[model samples]
Target: MNKIISAHPVGAGLKIFQNDPEIKIHDDVLYIPRIPGPHDSNYGIYDSYGRLVQTAGPRRGWPNFSLGQSQSSSISPSSSYPRATENSYFYGGHIGTHFGHFLTETLPRFWCAPHWYLNKKIICHSGDTIEKLFSVSWIKEIFEMIGLVKEQFIIFDRPTTVISLLIPGASFEENHFSHRQFAEFCNKLGRKYAIDLGISDPIFLSREKFKSAMRTIEGEEEITSILRNKGFRIVYPETLSIREQMGLFCSDRLTSGFVGSAFHNSIFCSSPRGLALCYGNSYSTNFWLMDQVNDANIQYFSTPTLLLKNSPRVGVPAEFTVDNPMDVANLVIDYYEEKSVLKKENEKINYGKKEGPYLIKTKFNSFLQIDRQLGKIHAGSGVGPRIHKIFAYVFDSQWIELFTLGGDVLSMDQLDSVSDTLNFKMQISQNEKTFSLKHPVTSRFVSTTPDGVVECNREYARAWEQFLLISANQN
Candidate 1:
């Protein structure tokens, strides 16, 4: 086996982004291990001391060999192929299908892998080209979005060199902390990738109906028609390209249907407040999905997984039911149904509903500024950059600002109230999927520059001007 020395994690406080991590450089080359074909759900990395690469920061003395990170493996590139040329370029590509597997079972490894160096080559360990097993375009699109460039990917056609190769576990246990961290990271990736790829902005459906898979959801036909009548679009994720799937997921305010890999779309899409994974009794099968959804700060609730006698077992236990689907549908609708009323001005607007003093964050991961301005254009410019809570609520037919980051609505005549200027409301409107935050009492949207610094008084219509309204306590 080829030996790697001075190999350690990139360091602490790194953000998880993609499926392939740049953990350490071996022989002056960075290695991105391949996910074994059969076991696609879990994987990890360990140093020669058998120490699993750690999430603890450098201050914690991470990559501590004393921790015992070693795990057993059966595959060794050294045994199968000739050693890699001492100074030749080597790349690893990763591949997988099955949305559930890809999201929970597959992605977390790459998410937390070291990324201290961005200039190195990143090879995908896909057994075949990513396109062969799944939608090739979609795979490439996701990889690039996560920071992998087309120039960095390479295919190993012949046994030129290799020695020992990294192995990502397929059936390994997923780390709860990492999964949650990655879930939020994946949500950001989904939005950024969709916008970058020009995936059309989504139309928010109160209940997007999707029931195409063969999993026998009892009374599915009736359920489908009922949801359709209730304004849910009959979406089939499998039929749509990855781009289209992302657009629909990112745009939709709420999406629902029988739980399965199809809903894996939610991993990357954060627009929805609640994703109702319909189930009947199989509470155990849904936790992985629940953990993922929760990590993204999106609400997930289960109704029932309906199935009949003699129904083939497909993981989740089935609960027999004959009640009208509308009753079950109420579980989601009651929570998500957007309330509206025609106004005297000939416009439909939010009427009587729970007005959220919700917090706002940019689709790109910046915390919204409440200062009516910002301190630094870039959040990562220094240590402990201030992240404040910026809140909003519906006003004048748009979601207007109730408070900005670091400041709140002035309740008393105290100095705080004077600084906030609560009387002059800031106009906020959503353009497509992005929210445009406007100046207090002006038409200008609260916007920022390419580097994230607040641009003074700019007309906000595009992405840099947009923000997502996450409920209070969501981060």
Candidate 2:
């Protein structure tokens, strides 16, 4: 096998390839190695002291080492590629910078599904790390062909983090300590990744420690009050139902923690803009599955040191100190502003009226007249100078009876008077399949039926009138 420098090392021992017979090293060019047995396919690089640096390939065969340049591969150059423009087309926070490399190489092939594309494009929630990452630059590249910025924009704020507690086990202390460490790691990650705010479950306290900490935080106030005043929201893992916890996570703008199965369950129902921050030192099956699901943005944070040991802790308890939440909050604000500006410019280019004549067909027997000053609908006869109200209501329960009654009903000059009193406009075609109405308070109400008349409830009529009033006020 070709020998390469190891990126990670343990102690003084250098790790090396085993059972690879077809590998060759020529002029510093390392050739692909052929592995023999189930374990033979594994390859590794070691330091001078036999410490392992990096490992690749499976145990049974050679791994594909192509750098995503194969023409036959799904990630070919001709794929729907993002624009190469720098700040205008691509923008991200700290974690974004770290994870950006993977998107460039994998997204074209992996994001082939139309649903994933749609979910990525039309975001319903904003004001979070994921929203900021998407709105600032990536969204522009995807929707540049269509003016996306000109539409109305609404942002929702999430202000809490929920944590799930693990069951007690043999290694409970180790798990608890590891969780604390993970919290600290995430704290650092937030700072580096420019995440402005974070909330996490406080570390479970030992009997002695819990009482001590409680006393210290509260000199005169009750323990709960002091914690609340200090901007802490205490949550018990068992207190919340699964659905409630999922709701919290789904609503959170950004969340970071271990790769717990609970997080997976929560994210399955989360909004598209939700972000799941996973610790690097975990099994990550749920995280991998989440990537497969492609619902929300999943970010994995790992340090070079964590790579040396294949066995990293999972579901550990730890205390994490968040430095500043305002920074992230401000960045989100700026991203939204940029998105708004870009959206407006795009709409101006795409919105225009059609320049051709069009015909409208309907099946109703009644007709309508249009109001010039106020847009509304009214019931009336076909021959009229002013607006008319076209009323179609059924008193009979049976369809035939209703039709007979409607046909035999007397035509009222009072109908014309009622129409005039209401300042209604209406029109009906000779075909008797369609009608329109314009009322004083309500705008035009159009309907079509084979019999030319349609039924309306009292509530609908009243609502229509109210709608017209609102429209008039706006005008």
Candidate 3:
């Protein structure tokens, strides 16, 4: 384990540190030796006075201290390392070719580049070539956005020493936390790059085209179809240019999709808008961090899924199926479509009136019915002429409590309404035909599991969880 060192704080989002003082370079310029790898044991950075720069070293608590470990440390360069030829900015450490990492972790350090180093070169320790970097159109566009050109990048493939190596502290950290300066930089880009082409249609960013389906949701096609039917333009973000992608997300419109790197494009939103994310079994805090800066109205829907141990996709280590596609779709539709309108509608519902001896239907095409013998609720196969399928919602001062109904009266156990299991807060659909139910107690949705067991245990409401109330009393 390498000893952790402290870096001198120069300003907000700026730190200076040193390591391995033996190979010294003169003046305030730090000598960032060729980092063979994090485990090389000798590679490090040093200040003018030979003090170690802590920022260049491994941060404690990272697994094997491998946040930025060099995967190709053993591969030596074909030629000798380039000598110190010209002045350059130190753009070393945590540099990568990954799009997501470049957007969040790597590009942030260069936020100050245009102001100070417009004429200077950027010295990077990564062995990747400029040609490969340029091959990624979005990466090249991002460079142009920051007033940087490919000519300014110096790929340090071998050991080299230089003078006055200006090292800037990272504006954003690994855990998705970013400095105020970084947020300001992003907002400035949002304003500069945001183009208004008069397009405000709701967009569903689909990752179905990506070759690597990491964390891909199974039954995503079914969900996409539902969104498409609701007038959401199904957008495959990879097919669009960086500018086009930015233009769509940066606008003040409803944006939604499966939670992944493609969604990270929301960082460029000049103005906050309605954003919905459908998640599999797992979730990422990166979106939450982006929300802290963007302030968009974001809603999350969880699709109950069983993680596949042997995923079919080539690069995907894990993938999950949407346990109830209809349920998931309804949750998203309710959020993007009816959230604002339903707020007013909810205020008008007279909880005391006879809402129903209602037949509750789920997106699964199943009817919510009681299984008295099991003392639990289950989604029945169809809306047959069964008394258990008929139910009523009773509001107990605050929450909409559900109870099994026998004939026209509410079912009773020991004289009181028998509602020990079902409780909800309802959001009526725009057409008043369907309703989304949220548990008043657990704050989850009433959903029918894959096996037909009904429970108010979903984090977000979906079609399987949404109830279409057919009031028997209504003519």
Candidate 4:
């Protein structure tokens, strides 16, 4: 059997030093070329007689030597082989180290999208304080649930991004003591894990841009009073934007807020380990929108908070009072710990399942709700032809035709005219099979025959029912 020997200096050049002087030495180390597949470089180094020795790499770095031999004849090494040093070899970086950087960079980018949309792109509405509270809690819960603890490496085989929300004017000044306590808590955790607490800067809203909104609420005085009462230092609004304001909440690994704010969106998207505390009140609109923005498989923890109240004449705001901050804190802690439990439950429920149909159902539900609201279809006589035109513009041609022609609404002449112009028609045969207009619209029509139509509808309904069941099972 052939063996690799360490290179030693023989005069001006290097030579391999073998215990058996009869073994020829190469330039530096001996080389055995053309080894069979499935055999390592060190293979066949020993024989049954216990003769050959195998040494790999340079003498300084790879000093260890071993022997392996078979019962058959021993092989010799080539004299022209060159020695390899430790520096010449390539080794990959540690998975944990790579993951840490990925979480730091990509997490922030994902979370910042919602903030970018609200503060820079959309100008339809401004966010509120209650929303901020809910968002903070949600983010904290999601992080804990995902098991994003310090020093632990999470490998994401697929491409993924994080999304978080950052409230514009939320402050930790009133919770200064809590902030300090949290910082200490993080420090302790860091020490135990032998990891560093790498906290990023806070994202806040631009105070100058929202001067009118800020002034209307006498925000400065109210915020200062609340902070002082909560034993936190008073923070000025003008100092940062909403994105920056989120820095305070994320001072620790744990943080939370409502589902609606751009700040919350940014944080949720950016956090490597993110939690989202969703108030049931905002689930219909804001939370749904958040789900669209993040796409991070966000773990939602429900908080028992009222979003709206009903009255006979005019609607009034729900009570915004909290009796105990400690209770809220305890809830936040418990939520994070429960994230793993929820994730395991989710895996068990969704195991061996396909996700495509569920995604389609979610999209359909959104389309249906928006269409009903915008078309005033549920408002009795209030809806007119103009609303139908608007709906046509809002929904894709396929969806418009699907809802319009599949229902009894086709009896109306106006809808027929619209369908004709749109080059779409929905017809039910004697066998109860549905067919679409010929050509381009056929693909959009979902089903073109009675049995197919029934089957398609049943499939969609069954998929939707399964989705609901999965959701219920998760809860």
Best by TM-score: 3
Q: Write the per-residue lDDT of candidate 2 for residues 338-378, one digit (tens) a residue.
A: 33121211101122332211122233223333332332332
Q: What lDDT does the true structure give each of the candidates? A: 0.42, 0.25, 0.56, 0.25
TM-score of candidate 4 relative to the true fold: 0.25
Q: Could you give candidate 3's per-residue lDDT for residues 8-74 as a string of tens digits? A: 1111111211221122123333334444332443344544344555555333221124344342333
Per-residue error (Å), model 4, residue 201: 12
Please identify model 1 stretches exceeding 4 Å from their true place: 1-81, 86-94, 109-135, 147-175, 179-184, 195-214, 247-252, 269-271, 282-305, 311-323, 337-475
- TM-score, candidate 1, is 0.45
Looking at candidate 1, the ten consecutive residues that score lowest on lDDT are: 1-10
RMSD (Cα, Å) for all candidates, in order, is: 18.0, 28.4, 17.6, 28.5
Tens digits of per-residue lDDT for model 1, 1-475: 1111111111212222224333433332222243445443223332333333343110112112212222422232233443444343323323455555555544554554435214444334454554464455665666666666566655444422333333332211222223344556666677665542232322222223443333444555566666666665666666666656655556435555545565556556654433444443222223333343334333334343333655546555443453456655554454455432212221223444436777656656765443323322221112243444445666554535355556543221111112342322234453445566543322344465555565324434566766666777654
Q: Which segments of model 2 are wrong by more than 4 Å?
A: 1-236, 270-283, 303-475
The Cα error of candidate 3 at residue 132, in Å, is 1.2
Q: Candidate 4 lDDT (Cα, whole model)?
A: 0.25
Q: Count of backbone clashes for each model? A: 29, 58, 13, 69
Task: Give lDDT: candidate 1, residue 245.
Answer: 66
**Could you tell me the C-alpha RMSD of candidate 4 in Å?**
28.5
Clashes of 2: 58
TM-score of 3: 0.58
